[model samples]
Structure formats: structure tokens, C-alpha cells
Target: MQIDWVTVAAQIVNFLVLAWLLHRFLYGPITRAMERRENAIRTRIEEAEETREQAEARARELEQERAELNARREEILEEAREEARRLKDRLQQEARAEVDELREAWRAELDEDRNEFLAAMRTEAREGFRTLADDALRALADTTLTERMAEAFAARVGDLDEVDAERLRGAVRRGEGLVITLGSDVSGALRGTLTAAVRKAVGDEVEIDIPESSDDFTGIRLKAGGETLDWTLDAHLDRFADRLASAFPTEDARETQDDDANGGRGAGDSTLGDSHGGTAAGGKGQASDAREGAAGDG
Candidate 1:
């Protein structure tokens, strides 16, 4: 433990120098490297925090977008429902209107048909009553007024115009001169009256061919060799029909002509030379031609 001051001082100096060297070469370098590593780690942590904040903000924005899309879908569904309701209401209204229109049309048609049927029934009833009354009057006249019947026939037939009256009178005056075939009955009282009227009207003597008795075929006949005028009930009927066809051309016209032929008037097809009578087929003229010379005697 003896004191060596010089050695002790030298050793202290050497220790100081060693410590400096270590700080410079080893400790100083280690500390500096550790400080650099800590600084890099802190910088990375700051970048990670910024990135996380950005992710959170992005997630909130996406939620808002999803909410807007749901709202848009609901609005579209509501619009579709409204459109469907409007379309349904329009179709129903149209169908109801069409049904009402059809019903109205059917009702009008039914009313027209009913009215026509009633009119036809009324006309038939009137015709029936007239026929009954006329038949009764004829029954009363047959016993009491045989001459009156002749007078009545002459009067009715005489009402024809001058031309028609002349034709009938001419046929009656020249009666028997035109007979080709002879039937069972030739003359009736009505036939005689017509013959007498014809002589008076046309100033010609008419000789009539009359059969013995009235039978199936009956009428006054006039014949002259080849030419013949059959005032038979049947022949006069056909001529009457042809004449009516030229005039009114109705079904009753045929029956009326038949009656005239049966009553002893020769109803051959008569032509009117004096009058300009139009036809019903042309639809240009009235039925006034019936009162003209075309239907003269018959």
C-alpha cells in the first residue's frame, strides 16, 4: 500500500482515455442507431393513424349512400302502385259506359218492333170487320134488290173515266162475236146489265153467248172466229192481276180484279194510250194512275 503517485496518475489518465475511446467508437454509435430506429417507428405510427381516420370517414359515407338508395326504391314502388290504380279505374269506367250504350240500343230496337206489331194487328182487325159488314149487306140485297144489284154494278163500273168506260162498253156490245170456247154458264143478271150498258155507252149492238146453267166455269163470253174475249171468272182474274201489277200492284188488287171478272166484265190487259202513267219499279210516280183509263172497264 506504499504510495506510487506517478503510476497512480498515469493509470487515471489511461482510464480516462479508454473511456473516451469507448464513447466514441462503441457507446456513441449504439445510442445514435437506437435513437434513429425510435424516430422511424414514431413516423410509421403517425401514418397508420391518418389511414385509420380516412377508413372511418369512408365507411360513414357508404352508410349514407345505402340510405339514399333505399329511399329511391320506395319512391319508385309508390309511383308504380299509383299508375296501376289509375289504369284499373280507367278500364272499369270504359266497360261500364259500353254496357250502358248497348242496353240503350237494345231498348230502342225493342220499342220499334213492338210498335210495328201493334199497327199490323190493328189493320187486320179493321179489314175483318169490313169483310163481315159487306157480306151481310150482300145477303140482304140478293133477295130484295136483284135489279138494284144490276144497277149498282152498272153504277160502280160506270164511274170509270170516259176511256175506260168506253173499252168495257165496246167489249160488252161485241160480246158473242169473240167466243172461241164455250163454258157451261155464259150470262148472269150482272152480265146482262153490263151488255146493256156497253150498247148504250159505245153505240154498238153486242150479242152475248150464254150457257144454259151456271157451273164450275161461269162468265159472259164473246168470240169472233180467231180472236176471243173470255170474260170468264178465271180469265178476268188473271187480266185483273196484270192490270193491278201495272197500277198499285198490291195483293188485294188481284182479288178485286177477280171479282170484276166474275161479275161479267172482260178484264184483259188494257193499255192506256192517252195517259203517261209511270211504274212503281221506277219509284218516280204516284198510284194515281189507278183512277185513269188503264183500268177503264175492268
Candidate 2:
């Protein structure tokens, strides 16, 4: 309680000195270390925040890439499916076309074979009939077939109508005289008879030539101007063959014959008559066959 100003002032001074020393040595260094540590920690925190932001951006980019990849895969699968569908359609069309081609080829081959067989049968039938007729005529009649044919021709010439006789006379007068072609040789008596008949039909001024030749047909053929007269055994056989064909006709032949019949044409008209009668009829005017007039004699 007693007042001591000097001592108290001295003590105050000492305390001040000690506080200054502590501040300079311990407090100053410790405070500066703490500030440095805080600054370092702050820098680390800022760096960590920046790294987190970068990672988030990378994740967003990855998610976008994944979506794009999924879309590309779906597109590729759809393209493959479309390609497969197109291939299937093309294959089916090709298969159908191939089958149709093969079917057509098979049908053509079958038709060709059938036609060949029918033609062969027809040839055989014609040959067989010719052989049979030759044998029968030789056995039944004491005369050769050629001689009988000539007799038939002479008879036909003698019985010619006025129109036919006039036409033959005109042909003989206008062109090269009448020429008679025979399949085989005839006796002098038969030749004389033929000559007389021709002379009676036409005038005696008309020249007549009878040429004997070994022809394929057993018949007589007369040529005057552009006109021809055919009376042959082959013609009779052809008529018989036509009748036989009518009895047993193929599908195509039957249809044709039916159409011809409906159009007022006879079956005989469509056939190849005795000794190329159809040809003579078309190329040169031909007289009617003598078989109808002298059937019994033949």
C-alpha cells in the first residue's frame, strides 16, 4: 500500500524488455511457420478441386462416346439384316427361272421324240403296203402291173370329157407334142391301143411320143404343154394310206383334219396323191385320176 514510484517503474521496464525478447525470438518465428503451413494447405486444396472438375468432364465425355458406339452397332445390325433379305429374294427368283427352263427343255425333247416315232411308223406302213399290193396284183392277174396301168390310162383318155379333150388338143397344138412316160415297157399291142386312143382324143396331126423308163412309181404320166395326167398304182396306195391315217390320227393331225373338214375340204385333198398328184395339181394343171372310171378293170 505505501507508494514506491521508482521501484514500480523499474519493474515495468524489466517486464517490457522480457516481452520484447519473447516476441522477437519465439513468437515471431512460430507465427511465421504457422502462416507458411496455412498457405501450403490452401494451395493443396485449390489443386484438389481443379483435379475433381477435370475428372467429372472426362466422365461426361466417356458417357457420350458409349451412346454413339451403341447407335453404330444397331445400324450395322440393320444393314446386315437388309442384305440377307435381298440375297434370299434373288436366290428364290433364280431357282424359279432355272426350274422353268428345265421344264421347257424336257417338253421340247419329248415332242421331238414323238414326232420322229410317228414318221418312222408311217414310212414302214407305206413300204409294207407297196410290197403286199405288188404281190397280189402279180398273183391274181396273169398280166404285169405296168401293162394293166397303161390299159387303164388308155381307157381314161378315150373317155375324156369334151372340155378335157379340147384342152389336151389345144396343148398339143400350141406346145411340144404330147409325151407319155411309163414306169415299165409295154407290149406292141398295148402301145398300139394307147396310140389309137390318143389319136381319137386329139387330131392325127398331133405328134405322140411314148418313152419307157424304169420309174419308182408303177403308173403312167402324160405331159402336154403345162398339163399333166397321173394314173399310178402309187396313187391308189396313197389314197388307202390317207384313209388309214384318218382312222388313227395323232392329236395334231386330228385337229388339222377337223379344221379342214369344217372348211368344206375333203381329207383326200390334203393328202399326197398317187405319183406326186398333189405336186402336179399345184405346179401343173392335172387331170383327175382314172381309177374312179376304171376301178373294176384295175
lDDT for every model? 0.52, 0.70
Tens-digit per-residue lDDT, 1-298, candidate 2: 6969898999899999999999999899999999988988888888888888888888889989989989998999999999999999999999999997887787667657755655555556555654565577888876666666667777878888776677778888786689877766788888888788888888888788887675455567666877666665555445545555545566566667778789867554646354255334532312354434233332
Q: Which ranges in model 2 have alpha carbons more than 4 Å from their true place? A: 1-127, 183-192, 211-218, 233-298
**For residues 1-298, what per-residue lDDT tens digits would candidate 1 score against the true structure?**
6979999999999999999999999899999999888888887887788788888888888889989989998999999999999999999999999997887786667556654554454444434433454466668754322244335434543554576545555555555242223333233665566556645544555554433443333333333433333333343333333444345433344567778668856443444321124223323321222232233324
**What TM-score, to 2 decimals, does candidate 1 have?**
0.31
- On lDDT, the leading prediction is 2
The TM-score between candidate 2 and the true structure equals 0.48
lDDT of 1 at 4: 94
Least accurate 10 contiguous residues by lDDT in model 2: 289-298
Model 1, position 290, has a per-residue lDDT of 29
lDDT for position 6 in model 1: 100
